[model samples]
Target: MNNHSMTRRLLIGLMTSITLIWLIATVMGLSVMEEEYDETFDSSLQETAERLVPLVVDDLFRKEEIVAPQQLQAARPDEEGEYLTYQVRDKTGKVLIHSHDAPPTPFPAPLQGGFWSDDTHRYYTATGVSNTIFVQVADAFANRREALSETGLALFLPIFALLPLGLALSWVITRRALAPVDDLGLEIEAKDSGNMELLKTDALPLELLPIAGSVNVLLQRLRNALEAEREFTANSAHELRTPIAGALAQTQLLINELGQGPGKRRAGQIETSLVKLNHLAEKLLQLSRAQAGVGVSEKPVDLIPVLRVLIDEFHHSGQDEDRLICRCAPNARLHGHYNADAFAIALRNLIENALIHGDPDAPVEVSLKADGSISVVNGGPVYTPDELAKLTGRFQRGHTTATGSGLGLSIATRFLEQMHATLTLASPASGRDDGFEAVVRFPHQD
Candidate 1:
């Protein structure tokens, strides 16, 4: 999960645990306070009853005369003062003396010592005097309930108040703890392919330092690999250029020395080889430039004029004029600056490839549209999906074209990439009769 999600889950878990603990503590505290209050009230009631038993023994045992109403009323004050109710009964269970407010049911049969009501709302105690006079005391639970409620409130109120404070503290603590991660993210955001370097390990937590170190190691390795590849390409191109140039110079000298005949034919062969070598060298340079991410700043450029120039150049170069065609969309313009040399090289390679591999009688058609794209269609056997996919790969030539240099499409692909464009090769949408088409799409600016 993301850091934010993980933090949220942790905060929720902590809060839940805290809430549960608070609830349990509150409940337990209330229970204990309630029990203590009930115990104190019950003890007071029992003591009052015990003390009254001795005084009321004679009155309770005297069955011949009833207790005077005034005497009963005088004892009622003690019962009321102690929050207790009392009743004095004979062996037959008839009440002889009772508090003024005593209930008709005689306070639910008390035990020999004491007993509690089923609902715990009252406590009752009794003492038997000579098995004839029994005195009972009952204490109401109003004060105990009030005390328990107050205790519960005391325990619960702080917890409720602290919940939001706890949440804010949790957020603050989490953010502080994760500060290194946020810093690392910002550092990574500032990085690009051109600046592949080891990230600094300082300021990272001990547990995460190893991860940051590993990432830095990976970046270092990648930088080394790219540097090695670039060096190799540069060295190989330098080494090959010297020999190719020497061979071309020697071939020109030999052509001058031998006039016509078999010598001339051999010289022509050498010239063809030189041309292929030059093409290969140029392609290598293009590939290297593409790998280095070369691109030009974009600006408005007119496509119609560019296409016309390319067409005129092709005609002037002795390419069959009748076999070449241009279909320009009227007033077609594109909003991107391209390296004119690179653009011409890419277009020439595509057209030359089509001319050499395509059916000689069929016209090679080039088209440009206002949508910042160009297409070159040639008449030839259409390639399958697999072949089309490999068409732009280095030194890849179709099965039918054995005499041709396989670098043509690769050079075009590299040039397009360097120009910040895309190249696609596919069979003509009009079916096999129109053969294959190579499409290039340029990144345009407004």
Candidate 2:
């Protein structure tokens, strides 16, 4: 899904640790190998020098002219043994007898008693009995470096060969190890309100079994709770609506019969309270149904006609009907893939909100734009951006004294959510000093 996935991170960390280990081991092994090779090879050179000294001394005692010994000369003209060189010199550093490849002049440094090295050669020097004769054995720097290089390549070649295989193995192992999690996700995703069966954990790894059990328990509890709530709400709303409608009907009849006095005024007020209660009950029922995702329709619905009917009802409420304006672009017909009942509920609540909260004298504008968006504009108090952001919260009203349940905008927002639309609230509708506007933007290309 991203570069930050756990599997990728694990592989990266594992590879990094492996590379570091190889590097550290290589360095330490090279250090040890250099010392051991130097000691072993240098021992062989010292043995050659030891054997040559007796022959050179014997020749010196015989008073013979300097002559190369059979063993001291190069075995062949151009073979690797030529990398070794030897010299015999007097105390003042005058060269006497020497190997074929040795320099006529003495070695670069004055003779020291033991092993020493300069830029080009590693030298081992020996002093004669009277300190008058000096013997030096030398090896080439390039020859030593070639030997070390071969040793290193031999030791590290296997690591380089195995790196690709290690990376591929890690990738496969990590994916297979995480397969149980992927299976759990697919199983949970397929579940719904009607399908709340426990997740099967029998084949899962031990680490995942507990998590699956916890999730199954949570799902069962939620299923039981929702079932209880739906049954109670369905029963309560029905039981309450019958008595409320009967009381209102009886109150209205009593208001007509009571005629003029204190009794008539009290009956009228009771009728108003009953009507408000009935409206609240209906709103609660609508809210519950919307939340439970009921009444969702697959059929496409016409939006404009339902809006027109809602606007007409404004006049029947004895308000100034002219304040409400409905504007639609000519030759444009609006349609959406949503339930007609849902769209009607959303539109009616928006219209009711504009009428109740807006200034009575200023016009409340309802327009369907060319972009297939519907906007409800009304003259209301100027609210800050923070207040507008919270307009759709349940039971949140513009004013506490307003004769409203405050669920209108919340319900409208919920219904629009089901239709893949949004309710955006803005204060001071464009170019105006003070007003609130609620815009419902339809889904693009729908």
Candidate 3:
């Protein structure tokens, strides 16, 4: 029951891939920048130590009694601070001369060349005057970390700005790319029994051309099958009408000729069978037409006259006029585009079903509502909802001994579907305790 859109999936997938790639690239960039920063700072630390060795050696050798260690003052003693600190140590691990910011103690580095580091600072030791004078420069770990942190931020900030823009561009591109698929799906969805036209493949992409071709082939085959079915049903019904009428007439004549005997009774049974068969054939023809979607029309039609004509015909056919109550609201109207003949067929079936299956003593009430809905109510035994649901199926009869072909509701439902209308059946009619009601509702009016 869960459905997902292809466009959304594609967009998310594309954006995720782009973001991951950017993150990976940024991580790699940060790694490389860290290494280069360490190398450049270390080279500068070694250079500063190497260049200061001779100066410290020269200053110490000229001193008149170098017994006490000396603290070298900076040229700008009032300046803020120094990032690099240095100490000049003697061969006996004593700090002989130290920079203004250097700690008073001798550094932990061994008196040798090259670099060394502890938890706090990176140290590079350079020696002069036969390795007796050792010049050590120390760089703080925090300084190196701050430089890498700034570089990493520069690498990461652009991803945030570019990610949203990338997602927006990807959304537009994905939807445009999938527009053809959406169009094809809609066109396929519009197909029904009433419209079986071939799919148009000329403008379709090459990837979708085969799907259109297959659907067209299937539509053609279905169209052929339905046309054959309609032809057979109509032809069979048309062919049998004359013979069935003739047979009924001959049986009636036989019943008249044989007066009140076993033979007369048998002939009467034959006439009844012929009548039922003829009615079934007519129903089959109507069902075939309904399936062919004969209820659709281009223009709205006035069907008030059609309803009256059908009622009059039913009255003339031996139904007492008093038993059929008809009422039309003054504001009631149906101006929807539909075939009048189809509307008549549907309403006639509802009325006929009510009259036949209803209690003989109770009158059937037919009414048109102000909103262009028609209702047929008749006194009858109440039916369960499950039982009422099956009434619209072909050859499904109700809990009655009434003589009917049982295709009335099925045919009416088929035609109403073609007209975009609905047929609703309810037991225990609106204001009654035990009755049946059939209502026809149109989708639109005027």
What's the TM-score of every candidate structure? 0.62, 0.72, 0.88
Candidate 3 local lDDT, 1-446, one digit each (tens): 99998888898888888889988998898888889999999999999998998888888878878754677876456686678999998888899888888888999999998899999999999988898888999999999999888888887898899888988888888888888999999999988877788989988999999899999999999999988988899899989998999999998888888988888888989999999999998898898888788897898788777888888888888865678988989988877678999999999899989998998789999998888899999998999999999999999999789889999999999999888899999999998999999999998665
Q: State which candidate has the highest TM-score.
A: 3
lDDT of 2 by residue, 1-446 (tens): 54567788989998889988998998899999889878876886777766767777776777656543323464575664676788887788877778878877678857666788889888887777587877888888788788899988987887788888999998999889998988998999977654577889889999999899999999999888877776676677778899999999999999888869999999989998998989888888777766665435676677778777777787677776778888887655667677777788888889888877788778889998877789999987888888776778888888435688888998898888877788888888877888989999887644
Tens-digit per-residue lDDT, 1-446, candidate 1: 64557678878998899899889887887777777877787778778878888788765455576743322755443454535677776666666677766654555665455666756346555666556667777766675666678778878889889999999999899878877888887877765444576788876899778878888887888878877887787678777888888999889888889987997898989888887777677667665655554444466454456567888988888867778888877656655667665677788888888777887878888888767688888887867898889988877888564366587888778767767789888875245555878888887634
Candidate 1 has a TM-score of 0.62
Displacement of the residue 30 alpha carbon in candidate 2, Å = 1.8
The CA lDDT of each predicted structure is 0.73, 0.80, 0.89
Worst 10 residues of 1 by lDDT: 68-77
lDDT-superior candidate, 2 or 3: 3
Residue pairs in collision within model 2: none
The weakest ten consecutive residues by lDDT in model 2 span 66-75
Once all C-alphas are superposed, what RMSD does model 3 give against the true structure? 3.1
CA deviation > 4 Å runs, candidate 2: 1-12, 43-64, 67-82, 88-95, 99-136, 140-209, 299-320, 331-336
Clashing residue pairs in candidate 3 are: none
